[model samples]
Target: MESLQALQDFIKTKDNFRNFVNSSEVPSVCKTEPCMLGVDEAGRGPVLGPMVYGVAYCPLSQTSVLKDLGCADSKALTEEKRDDIFRKMLTEEASLNNVGWAAEIISPNYISNSMYRRAKHSLNEVSMNSAIDLIKKVAESGANITEVYVDTVGPPEKYQAKLSEIYPNYKITVAKKADSIYPIVSAASIVAKVTRDHALKVWQFKEGLEMTHAEFGSGYPGDPLTKKFIREQVDYVFGYPMLVRFSWSTAELMLQDKAATCTFEEIDDELPKKKVKSISSFFSVKSEDGAMKRKRHKFFEERYLSMDNAFE
Candidate 1:
């Protein structure tokens, strides 16, 4: 982030956005250097603001640059400490010249929409797709990518196999806690955390709510302030604003308990269904294809045809 004013100015009504940083900081010749990229994310477990996916890459031979910049376990760092490290990366010559970073700010609305889709896209899928896109974007821009390291909570084998299939040329490594083990992934995590922090810091409400992030706590469902917000700042009809991931059970359950009674009518609009033939149709008639031929109702006509006498 450039400045508080700049971050505030960057806020938009759009659900998601992306930013690339330090692209020009690296010399053009560095593009030919064997690049190793790292991927990580922030706010995945939060119900507030946006979940940010960040990718950081540099020449494989320049691995020492990240270490020198103190790119280590982000979870071990204080918020202020993380901010200082990111600022140094942006302002320092040695760090800036060696690193290129990009981030995808996946909005809560996007998450809700994806998870609520007819087919339902899982959050892991969305995160993986974002990471994949970032990697491909950097490679397409002419970085000589050789190895990719990813930080993930899910099974590493599946994710590694998926990425290997996509970028078969690159050596892919997806592991649990790569952020703590790989400096590049740590750097990416710092970038993601800072980006998401700023996103929440400058979150603009379109729902006319007069509150701030301080009142919403850390966006974790367990956060006292977040639970308070879900219970207190709800609309009778819409529940929370677009900033909240409605698909999350925390928000949904809160809304159901505290907000208005909401009901949904599932519209089965798929060609009025196939109209499965009744079991009796099998015995009634058969078509040329040896299946039931749906016939018109004939209960009254059949009753009259079966009568022995008209009076009886």
Candidate 2:
């Protein structure tokens, strides 16, 4: 395990647009006793900084150790309280014996790239995959994981089903407020929230913004400082720095209204037809009113499919 300062320094060294993981050595007790793992995330709503998915595992019988460390509902805890709990998790002998944790930091640029790709990937998919990967990493690190708990915002049944399918041997529970209901999940939430807070604090803008995190305040769209940054700190050609998620509506709409307009060529999803067909089609499909109607492929016609003017 790294000291808090070491973790922050490590995060600062990485490229702002890439994803990375930080993990502790698996506890000796975890390999011998049946363990429960909890997963949760933070910063999903923030337009600034990285979203963090965190997983924490401990022996099923030693959950009381977490309580002693002050692990509870992370959202209910103050920043100082959360930091104290995390500090104990790093330094306390009892916690070191029973608990192990890992966090994946999903960068804002990565989120934007995934959503803006030719075949768009939704934020839900990104969040799910990050959680799954953390679980896999913990299992591979020699934890005898038998139960898994996840806190999620969307419908739990589908998420639970997906996790159950992936790890049939383990008992899986995906709930709306698992962080508050489960101690292990609360621990995971603390890990995620603390990591996200530090990530923003240590953020070094490659685009050379002179202001610090305090100037930008929280990354929520409603924050006055964040709104000011988005409104005033746009580049005419490249838009905001990597810290801002371009795919987010808050950033996209601001860029559209404030920056120079850029129109990209439309994506072509079909193969080009031969020139020979073009000459025949020009003369063959004229209506009685002298409007040209392009002939459709037999396969499309049979299915009653018509071309759509995407631009219109």
Candidate 3:
């Protein structure tokens, strides 16, 4: 998006539960010169809002432009600084000529569904797939990408090997804190972090909560506003709105305490089905023994009342 308002407008129109992408046009110089792309994510730990994966690419010769734009460890930068850098990416002549970026917003509902399915898909898989998709999309748009740097989602060596296997020609480096070490990855982090911040800022609750993101805070369990939202906003049958990630333990535990308990019939195809007695067995009368029956209540006993077979 060219501006924060434009990003908010775009997010408002989409189905909140579905994943979507937004990207800038690949600069002509990027297509002609060998380029490097970096990948990073935001909102991975939050119980609310979408997780965003962003990729930033530029010609290898123009890496200096990233430094000029003040790209650094995104986590260390204030929210205002990230927003300013992103705005510069939109307006600055040097940045526009050299840098291209893309982001995929992975919705909380999509994440919950992935993790809750019978054959569960972990969050790491969802994250890696999003990163791969963004990189491929950049390449398909004719960026001459020769190297990829990634902030690790899980184990660095394993993730690096996986990306290398998929893009044999491209050099891939996946490591912890790559956002701090690589300027391109830092730019990607800014893109992802800014997108996620705006996503929550403009969140429209399809469940009709009549509330704003401010009311829910940052979606971290430690945030008092978020904790209050989780404690108070609950549906007995369906649980919380799509804004909350149902698969997160924070959401799951809160829902368990506040919502109605629901059970489903579980079928196992591998186990042999046992033939059981009919439903009538539950009501069948057994032969009475000489043993004493249950005592009558005091009220009945005081009246010398007795229970007998009405039909007899």
Candidate 4:
């Protein structure tokens, strides 16, 4: 109860926060012993809330400690179960003496800004960078990190190579389903999932929505409640509050069709040019009726179905 209250109180104190972190105080736990660390993330797909990255570490020889605590794939556990495990990690001396953890919550507003930047940083880059930062933080805090395991959705070769290049002293392995296979990764997953769940649970809407997060559902685009919120709670001009990732196509399409079109920046006046009789300009520019009528050539179309548009 004290830990949960402390978390909520920390959440409430930030007024202009874009990104924030929660970290352990580098407990004197096995400080001189080599350790293994794991990294995982949650809420990457949700469009309505902050995404969280978490890392957990413990002495290399204390693998049994985590096993005894029932650290398993977070997806396989109920929310209540995950919460119980995390709470145990906080309150139990055996667990606390062997484990240390940290988390970073990347705000939706920050995600939207990165995606909409002039140079446009892709979400994958943003996520990878966050993971790297967390691992680096753990290592720099005097943890003798000898190995790292990461859970990934993309191919593992590139991510493994990057981390290995930076921390060659550590054995870095990036793999799909790692959270299920690795106890440390599973611990990280629990931390991430619980943090994300609570973040949405205690969300304080700056825009003053009268509904709870339960009413908005899980924030997945397919969730009927989330779809309803995106479609019905729109602000028309400002769109949904900053809680929503404005760059998501779900929100973009909604704004394009249902709300006034909005742009982030101002543009200079159009350049003067001699009138030409070219016919392709009609296909390239907006029509006189203010509609984009040119259908993309059937063969030369975008072949992917992903929202990470910043990545080219």
Supply the global lDDT for candidate 4. Answer: 0.83
TM-score per prediction, in order, is 0.80, 0.84, 0.84, 0.82
Local accuracy of candidate 1 as per-residue lDDT tens digits, 43-153: 999887788888788888888888877888777888888877676655545345578777788878889989999999999999899899988878878777899999985
Candidate 1 weakest lDDT stretch, 10 residues: 15-24
Which ten residues in a row are the worst by lDDT in model 4?
298-307
Residue 30 Cα positional deviation in candidate 3, in Å, after optimal superposition: 0.6
* lDDT (10s digit) by residue, model 4, range 1-312: 236656666766664238887866554654688888999999999878888999999988889888888899999999889987887666645345578888888989999999999999888888898999998888788788899999985779988998899888899989999999999999999989888888877777888777887999888899999999998988867788877998899988888888887566533335566666688766585667977666655554565433366366
lDDT of 2 by residue, 1-312 (tens): 446787788888888879999887888889889999999999999888789999988999998888888888889999999987776666556345478999999999899999999998889999999999999999998999999999975799999999999999999999998999999999999999988888899999888887888999789999999999898889998889888988889998998898999878765636585445655555676677978676677987786666574335
- Range of the 10 consecutive residues with the lowest summed lDDT in candidate 3: 303-312
Tens-place lDDT digits, model 3, residues 112-163:
9999999999999999999999999999999999999999988999999999
lDDT of 2 at 215: 90
Q: Pairing residues by index, what is the TM-score of model 1?
A: 0.80
Ranking by TM-score: 2, 3, 4, 1
- Write down the TM-score for model 4: 0.82
Q: Which candidate model has the greater lDDT, 3 or 4?
A: 3
Q: After superposition, how far is residue 42 of candidate 2 from its true place, in Å?
A: 0.2
Of the pair 1 and 2, which is ahead by lDDT? 2
